[model samples]
Target: MNLSICVLPMHEHLIKVAVVGHPSEGKSSVIATLAERDDIRISARSPETRECHSYDIQVGNQTLLELIDTPGFQRPREACAEFKLYEERIGTDNIAATFLAEHGQDPRFDAERKILTPLAEGAGLIYVVDASRPISKDDRHEVEILRLTGRPRLAVINAKADESTHMDAWYALLNSTFNLVRPFNAHRASFAERMDLLRALGQLEKSWQTDIDAIIAAFQVDWQARMDECAEAILDCIEAIVLLRVAKTCNADDRREKERVAQQVADSYREKCAKRERECHQAIRRAFKHQLFDPAPVTELQHGLLDEETWRLLGLNSRQLRRALMMTGAALGLTADVALAGVSLGVGTGTGAAAGYLMGRYAMQPLSMLRAHTRKDSWLSRSMRREIYLGPARNLQIVFVLLDRALGCAHLARNWTHARRDHESIMVTRPTAATKEWSQVDRDAISRYHVAILKGSSEQVYERRTAVRELLVKLLAS
Candidate 1:
């Protein structure tokens, strides 16, 4: 199912948090990454978020939370110094509110007013900071400013993954200022880690805990559904590839005439396989909620999909193919024996071994084209083109290649936060590991899948595909 169909829960009591921090501290980046909304304006330079913008996080097309991205605190120290004097006038609790009321249009306090307005209007404060940098006077002043507002506040330490020299210091200081503190890297975190942070936000205030609980639950359901759909998409591609075939009638034609027809059919079959695989990949991108685009003309996918280099690199060339065939054959034999109630175990084993040996003989040769010559076309017209059939893409190695590349893309797409606006291609660096995760021992789902692709009923294919899909989902999760 697509995300739009998932009936996720929603609560009327909204959880609104104002993302605030000093300029160039990744304040907008944090919000962008958390919301998984790339449309949010983000920049590393000062004053990126000039006007306050609120992003509504929807579940099942219903708004559950609102994240307000506001201008960074440019004058935190001066504002805090000035507001401190007003503590004696109307007490510290009303200082932020009073400061907003009086200086709403003051150009000098323009950024400060935009940031405090949400906190003044009951939105929780999500103070962001570059924890890699040492704590400064401005950081303390901003923390004090939010503390004086008497509102629920949380701190997110946005530090580089490799930069940890000052993380301990930030944790100690931020724990004193906010209800909860978490360390996060906007660029490299996984989907699970992002959800973990959102869950932490739910615990910041008791007033919104119930509603936030509902949001978290709904979000989890939505994510799980996406993973399931993605897995199904990958298997669906396999099913299509397995079922693809091109047939042509062949008369009592000469060898050259038959070879011409074979070449034509083989070429057409290759094109269809490539096209179908691309369509499946696009479907996967949509299922994962990524903006879908045909990235084939882009060499990464084009080359990796069927390149001979990839086959050799993945070790599916000679040795691995023989190994995979033997495992699949043994599993097939076991399945047949089970079907025969152990009465024909030898029959199953011998037939399966023969088939496996025949397949292994052409381990390094192309299997996309085959000859199934028969005298069935005796009544065919001599005028018609002497035809031969090709495909269902007989190459089993193609499956291994596509699976390896697809898994790599899935891994990257699921982990990539929408905030990233780059065009980095998902690369399949380790093809051997990708296709050989299954062992030869026993009739495991993968071994069964290999057997089914060769000769199994549609129902058998569906069942094995479903199991393989679940395993792929588990891989993504890990």
Candidate 2:
């Protein structure tokens, strides 16, 4: 047998950036946010990274960039003194290489050596500093050491505090030393801010401009794809709720037993709908690369999806609903015919116009008897017993409510950055009345989709569902 070996080609000119800073200055957090890597060990109690670790910013098969998380400088002043001594002996050409050569095995300069090792290997530098605190001599020393390395560097102000009073001083110091300085909130940086930082990185080296542009383009395309996925998940959740039905067989003559069965079906329906909604949110989280962080429902919106407050806050108001009904060709004066599985509901104008307002104002009765079908006893000669259906909800307000909640949750998940490690949940923004802002075109499209779902036409449902998805993608992008 012949032995065959193959070597995979490495990405030529892969941008390597070493993130260096003092302990607890958010070097790891910056990398986590920029790279969207949740596996990076980050803690508030103490510094988590004790050595240099390289993480690739991979887009599919290509590694566009590499972020090197390095240990914080333990003794920058001492390291700066060593640099001066080396510059005098080795003449400033390869200060990083010469210093690492001498201090590579030294126990006292272990962190310094690891932090500077990447610079020795020609990696660009990203020096992180907390702009919230006052500048010190040690910071100056650290900057001096990086400057002597002769590598293109960018200064990042990682302001962890709420009120940063010394931002001016930090910028003044960084401006004189680093090629470019940018303030990045690792825990709160949005996708746009991250992109801005990448553009700043491109400015560091003229040769790296094309590569940086390509990476940014890839990221933009990936973000749009994720948004599209999120839209599909949200629409799927709403569709499941719209098409949901739960039934129970109860003796039609026994009113008490019938009521009990109805209540059970309603509860079950609520839970199923809520579960679908949660699964949608989880899908959105995955789209944003939040595999480890499961955001809890902390706001008022988390109070059960069928809660009275939820309905009131999220569902369309009475006026909006009335207009939407009219737009869908619902006759105002005559007994209004709202489609419910070919079951025509004779809702009067007062009922139709006030439906949304009443639903929002009072508690929502999630399930109602669609119809009772009688079945004859085959084994024994017995009277007809009825099987009661509790759902495929008849109330049109639910469509708007589900739409609002799904859109609001998608917005929250979309904005939730990967760097946030806190247990606090993303607050569901209110008045989650998402449909109230819909253009006439949007409302008309949704109305058609609603009718298509109720009519149970596969072809019409597919066309209408596709239209809704396109609308949702635009909304999510906005």
Candidate 3:
């Protein structure tokens, strides 16, 4: 089954903790105990987990905690052979196994060489020991192996219900050998006990707190960066659609031919845009998979095609959409008849922005010619006689008009301006340093967004964009 993974934006306040121990030591059970969730399967036998498993735990609406479970450590002799085999196959020695194989030859070091794999994955060791047996050299060796991982670790003394003696020796050895130590009954571990264990983990290393903080901060920064990129991609798609539309309306010699060409452009543009959207989605999802909240829903928007729901979802109200449509129609005029042809060409070329602009220009030519005639009545007959020359002129006028409108619409949408005020807002603020910065950011973000779209799905790209936008807004506000 395909797992639907939502990537969580990097936050400045999240923690990722891994639970690791030797086989048959209740590593999975500890996770179940800590999470208070029965989703993880537990077993009394060894080697239950063969690969890594990750779980996201929510501490609050905005706070997330991640836990990774790793494969059980193997016996020293078996581990060395596995290491040699793995090294030969992969063309590189496995780091964990190398450490174990080097140390496993000594008879006194067998237990110490066993718990290497779990240690290598940066899992702070939760060395589980059965308190039923007397303190032995083997347990001491295991502690030595965990220390080799060079991570902050905790020792969990699993006291079998019946035997509780020899606690002093265990405590003494732990104090001298391990980083932190605690007692946990896997079968009867309570929530309070789990919280205490986490608290101990928090204090295991003096620098762990800082590392967790850094990871969160990185997440937030990355998320904002991605959103800006997605917004730019959306604009690119719109621009292409507009350019194609203008081209179809102005350039086609015959009506049917014009319609056919436009349709081709539109289809090509749609496929390219769809591909881009997918890439953006996958990148964002991967980045934010560990977050607490689900990301904003992703919706695929087809270039130059507006369904009622899509229009509404663009954050435009019904009246605003109607106005935009009216403006588009007016701008399109007789050119609307050639829209299908233009769409086709746009889709074929996979260049929606250029096609849309071209179609928009084609539609605007007649209006420009009419206006020119009204202004120069003395030249009316001559202009009428020169109607044949109007094709190129009409095309140019359509191009300019469409370019202006498409860009204006993009700006208004990103700036969160309502449709009624969009025209007035255009060119209202003189381009400044802040505007330039925003523009650059938008450009960079869009380029990255396009890369992501090309790699994944529309929904995936949209989600990444949303996360990025949210992060940027938050950062700017701060």
Candidate 4:
């Protein structure tokens, strides 16, 4: 989402936090999760990062926070020994700056210098450790080094797996030296957990409290705006697919030609609907800040939209389908009654309701488009010209199916963390229909919206679209 609101003034200090740790301790993963950035490279291989990189959390033109991903400490014991000796010799508390002054250009201390550059420059520290592993002497040395830097520090125990057998040991050691310690799973951190981590940053320094709160607020607002745009995209996709129609001019003398055109129109309608749905899902992914990963492949998603499993899993049940159909048909009947000046004494309403019930019973059948019919192009033409029409879908099941699929996409986009790189594991599965849990009011709103689209009433469409969009925004928020 391109956040345009200038939440902070240009003169405000850009909060800088350095993510530092031992080699292969999930420092990069932590940064990736916190920055909401998947472009940051994360690997299980040792010494993957050889240099420092910066990621800025910005809204519009203003930078809110700057997270520096520094190279992991390769010689923490040696660095700690040197720092202790220097502090003893100089009788000073500013050991980090003094060490950098002496060894900033030394080749042997390249990694150490790079790691301490941000700390010496007054950046807050987020030290990551693999809590799933046993504590080592080097880990202690690393903790001592950060303690001597005198920067406000937050220790993050990034447990790579579900195993927390060594968590208590790590926490005990971290609590003595760090201002705050928290266990954050980089691979599976939720939106709320990420926010909690930000709040913890606010507590590290009293001077940083207001800035941290403002950054958190900006992030919340940015996320909500993304969801609102997603809601708009979903609504637009539904309208496009629901009102979709295809046509072709056919010859008057050729019956076989007309049949061929009808078949072509059907194919076109399916292809167009599938394509539009894919585009909408992609838009949702972008809104959630997904740039490198896709929940599923394009062909897989396109075929899955109308696949049998998707229909069975996501389409509305018999009872719900009946209610939706009856509601829509009753509205249509009311329109007809108004046209007839109420002369048909409630007959239209009864017939429409019965028809709706019958259609509902058959709604779960195989997907099919409305039968193609031909109409004269114009009466003034010299020769009779006919046009064949193919859609505005006949089966109401497609509406429910499409909605469920869009919701599933939004769900994955919002919840999929950037630290996850295993493509197969992140691939989209047939999601349970979230609409099954929606209340009657929600269902009624959808039905009315569908009716509005079908009737092609511009004013009714505007009102109903607003209602449905508001419903979707609430759902996505939850």
Per-candidate TM equals 0.83, 0.87, 0.34, 0.89
What's the true lDDT of residue 345 in model 1? 24
Angstrom error of the Cα, residue 177, model 2: value is 0.8
lDDT of 3 by residue, 212-288 (tens): 33333443454455445544443444334333311222233455544555455445444553454444333333332
Q: Which portions of model 1 show Cα errors greater than 4 Å?
A: 1-11, 45-47, 60-62, 247-264, 292-304, 315-320, 327-352, 364-385, 425-432, 441-444, 450-454
Model 3's C-alpha root-mean-square deviation from the true structure amounts to 18.6
Q: What lDDT tens digits, residue by residue, belong to model 1 across residues 1-478?
A: 1123344444466678999888878777787777766667666444678988988876566666788988888888889987887786778775678998878788999999988888888888888898888889888999888888877888988884467888888888889878999877787667777878887888888767766666666767777877787777777787787667776765435667676666676677768877877776676666566663223333245354545555555425455565565666565663433322232225453554454454545534444224432234444644544446554543456566667666666666676666565544433233333666544432146557756876788798778877787788887566
Indicate the residue-level lDDT of 18 in model 4. Answer: 93
CA lDDT of each prediction against the hidden true structure: 0.68, 0.74, 0.44, 0.79
Question: What is candidate 2's lDDT per residue for 55-156, written digit by digit as tens?
Answer: 886555566678999999999999999999988877788799999888879999989999888899999999999898899899999999999998999999
State the lDDT of candidate 4 residue by residue for 292-397, as single tens digits.
Answer: 7775463345456666666677768878887777777677663433222222334453455665575566556434333466777888876766888765664567
Which candidate leads the pack in TM-score? 4
Residue 302 Cα positional deviation in candidate 3, in Å, after optimal superposition: 61
Q: Can you list the residue pairs that collide in candidate 1?
A: none
Task: Rank all candidate structures by their lDDT, best first, as comma-separated numbers.
Answer: 4, 2, 1, 3
Considering TM-score, where higher is better, how would the candidates rank from best to worst? 4, 2, 1, 3
